[model samples]
Target: MKRLILHITVIAITFVSLGTYSQNNAFKGYTIEGDSVVFTFDVRDYSKFTQEYTGQVLDFTDFEIENVVVSGEFNLWSRDHWKMNRVNEHLYQLKKSLQDFDDEFSYEFKFVINNAYWAEPSKEDPNITKAAKNGRKIRDVYNLKMYTAFPKKDGNVHFKLKGYHDARKVVLAGSFNKWHESLFKMKKTKEGWELTLQMKPNIYQYRFIVDGHWMEDPHNTNKTPNEYGEYNSVVDIKEYTAFKLRGYTNAEKVILAGSFNNWNEHEFVMRKMDYGWKYVVPLSGGKHHYKFIVDGEWIVDPNNEVKEYDGNGHINSVCMVK
Candidate 1:
């Protein structure tokens, strides 16, 4: 059941032609510094008719644009099926007719401004706990990747993300070109804060707000993952190792007597295939993270491939483990 094309009058005519959105169409804009960028996005809420269908079809050519500086290839014309994604991260590829194909769905492209989030959902915490709720008045957490039209040459793509206790600065937005975030910040070395971005590969999702919370990329590579089970905010500048593989079912095989290798059938004895229990873990290719544990009592991961969040938080599932 995978066929849900998008086309709602090319997203209400580009929101009446980007009238009131800043940053060159900023619903949270981004365009990192030229060399290529003419992409557009809008999928007017999508549609569907009944009674033997009415009239509306979609197949937006082959939408593709990539991460890690310089990668873009575009083609979407079911009357311009609303476009974006034409990647080329320095020959890593995505433009050549959209690197063949491997399909997935849930494509909406109208942005009212949602830089998606997930900063510090617990990278183990240790002693660093951000996320608040006392009086509640803090927003702006968007750290995305794909920079380096020579951010310092040599395939650069580094970062630091120091720990802030009271904070005043720390911003990095996503989608490569929307939500530009002060032309790039995050440098404070001596082995604590570094910043680099020279990309052109593919795969990106981002988050990070610091003072007010919202974070990810404890390393990088944990692409989209959201729904009810959260964690879907990414960043993949490319070394690859972002784990986001989930699929479960009625899994419960325990015995718990004296504790065998079974350890009470932990992780449901590992499944991942028979069309249900599957969970892979590893993230660094570009970082973002979220999940759900169930029986043990950690929840989220309702199958959200990245709608965008960090504001209305909760409901996570995202990975980065090649």
Candidate 2:
């Protein structure tokens, strides 16, 4: 009888060991190999992809993850364009093909998990690196993780100025090419004046000089005011994050105040649109806290629900800078 009981106990222990091994061997749903970053979502490990609130795990399955996307500086940080594919039962995958931009390229990226939460690299992840400012490791730029198929080529930017036909000459000046006034001279065209410049991928703040007067590009809607209270036409030749707010058309002015611009309320005034306000600002990867000042009233973003306490008895809207 004792031998029979011992045999039953041994059998139970063997089954338990096999069950634990099976659970542990499940696919983790993500892998970074060579120049490619791959994500494999497996339903068996669904609990592992969830966010932890306090001590409880907030399972993402409850929200019914409709989609997943990977975005970063490489794609100009578009919010919802790169969608992943579901391969099979409880399995989804996204394989990002990288390009080589010549130099030691580094870029920050994030996973738009379930089209709702912007998931950062796990703290325990071996690839995660420490970042400056905040203790958050999400800002760490992945160095050459994704290699481009071809080398980066120079882009041609054509500058045009209208109604400047009467002027003797027009020069292009900005951060690009060292703001040289005499270097880029515009040729007169039937419509106005134009100049084509071959430049690398970058953001440039420029103005057209007609005769002796320096003026912003009237045709371009994007502009940034300088310290001297002058507006400079802004041009983005690379990827950048765009911010938008809606339902404040009646407000006299709406300004984008955030940690990126040192919380300068007047520096980044947003342009009014038919539905609301819009502005495109270049920001590095990581986390950013911001608020909108609509006609002097500081308010959190009505559209963005992600927020955190500002310690001053105010709630600031939070955003991931990927």
Candidate 3:
């Protein structure tokens, strides 16, 4: 009788294990490189320590990728969707010529995916009248916030970003300052995480790493809208002006060069100005974004549009030279 009981217990345990495993989610990934986007399944953030995080590329060559959904964004919180592209078996290219934006303002890739009509992640929210209104369902680690005379300061570009393992101490890691935690160290508050990146003035691109999970901001302000459905945020940094722009840079041009930008050393180019070197490129003349590319360096402009993307695939910015 005891043997029979043991066998039943073992079978029950196995079934439970399998059930738990099946409940997990399978996510595919893609990268936002300049004006192009690439499909990949092997992007992993294996950060061993808090101060510094690590990343590795997983093997996705043999993986069966079907019914794939790929999207990109600039910011994570609000609804700012500057760069919106779909992923194909090979890769989906953004047809729009953002070289002007890249040349002047900066752009970054933000992403979110649906498990293909998968169930179980949904819950009941009485206040949420429309069930489909809930767009972002996944939770992540850290988020980004800007301070000072920058535009979009009115909850326009919110980023419910990924975390640093357990938030033991979360910092915004990026190439703007050697991907160091000290510079972009975020402040935690009851509302959420916050930080201020005093970039010089130039177009910049970056991503968020939470506890090794590579994800875009959940609360992205500039989330782009889509035809089929859903949205993606593309972060954009504007140009800098003396009164509006704070910080200092004494050089001809400041282009962006970092790990994300292949560290080309001469990637972005910042134009010069009278008081300081500025990326004085021609924008539409409305409220536009322009970053300084002084002496081969990239910095976020302290002043510009602070708009988020609508969930329908559009673009907007508020932190650049107008």
Candidate 4:
């Protein structure tokens, strides 16, 4: 009788240990640390997918989940880029860093299990799911909203478009508003049309749609070509780096050309001040090579001490930003 009781106790202990192991291997949700976002998945939840469709008890214990990967818009929806790591017996995780990403960009991602099964978030809970759908083969069906980084500041910058007197309607479109043409309408002013947008310290590409005619900002010379081969006015709504070139006061036109603006000769025209020609441009935190275009002659910054060869036999002024 004592041996019979000992056998029963051993069987109970085995079941309890299995139950605890299964519970420990369950998904514990995602984690966010600074610019990194971590996604976690549990292989045990794979049965949920079969149960949802067949309405029957499906055991996934025998099914082998070999690999898991993350595919998303940030990586251009590449299937083989971000492979998840198996943390425990059933738990898998993938951590992605968005430190180099823009201030605010929307992205969508889904997990691929065994390189064949595509798992997505369930409607009930976004953090935990075992739902796999075939419709997700179409990349546009992604429904996850992920933010890369937070904005630095909440400040309103005034954007003005001048000399469009005959325009009946004007709209401001750019990266901030997802380049929506008719989203932010500009108010008509005596000088032209103006709009105040709450913006953070970042570089933005924008254009004015005056009476349905897309045009670059006439007053702002900073412009860049968009994906459509059309020019869009670029604005840096942040702290300015005063690029001054002394002894260029007598020049007809002084332009600020730099790696920041893709070496565009006519993009940034400098103002002829009393001492020299000055151009205040919003430069992000990095090192940049620049030159001054004084009457079509490229010249390095006279005031700047740091200089580097531009691989084209010409020395360029190097500006370092903290």
Q: Point to the candidate with the largest TM-score.
A: 4
Clashes within 3 Å, all models in order:
71, 5, 78, 0
TM-score of each: 0.18, 0.33, 0.23, 0.37
Ranking of predictions according to lDDT: 4, 2, 1, 3
Q: Model 1, 1-322: lDDT tens per residue?
A: 1111111111110101101111232221133223233322222211211111221232323323222121111221121232234343212211212122111111111121112111111222121222222122222211122222223322234444554534666655555534344444554444344454444433445555554455554544444664536453554333322222244455452111111112233443333445555433222333244544444555444565653344457433444321
Of the candidates shown, which would achieve the greatest lDDT relative to the real structure? 4
Reference-based lDDT, residue 293, model 3:
40
RMSD values for the candidates in order, in angstroms, are: 23.1, 25.2, 22.6, 21.2
The candidate 3 region of ten consecutive residues with least summed lDDT is 12-21
**Candidate 3 Cα outliers beyond 4 Å, as residue runs:** 1-166, 181-183, 221-234, 240-322
Q: Score residue 6 of candidate 3 by CA lDDT.
A: 10
Off by over 4 Å in 4: 1-37, 42-63, 97-105, 124-136, 139-142, 149-322
Model 2 accuracy (lDDT, Cα): 0.56
For 1-322, candidate 4 gives per-residue lDDT tens digits of 0100011012110000000001121123444443466767777554432322223434555767788777666676566787889899988988766453445644555666565555544454422322235343432232344431112121135566666778899987777756655657887878777665444345667787888888776556667887788788776544457888888666899999999899998889999888988888766645789999889888888788899997788889998643
Candidates 1 and 4 compared by TM-score, better number? 4
Residues 119-178, candidate 3: write the lDDT tens digits: 111113111111212235322222111111121122112333333434644445443433
Q: Model 1 Cα displacement at 25 (Å)? A: 27
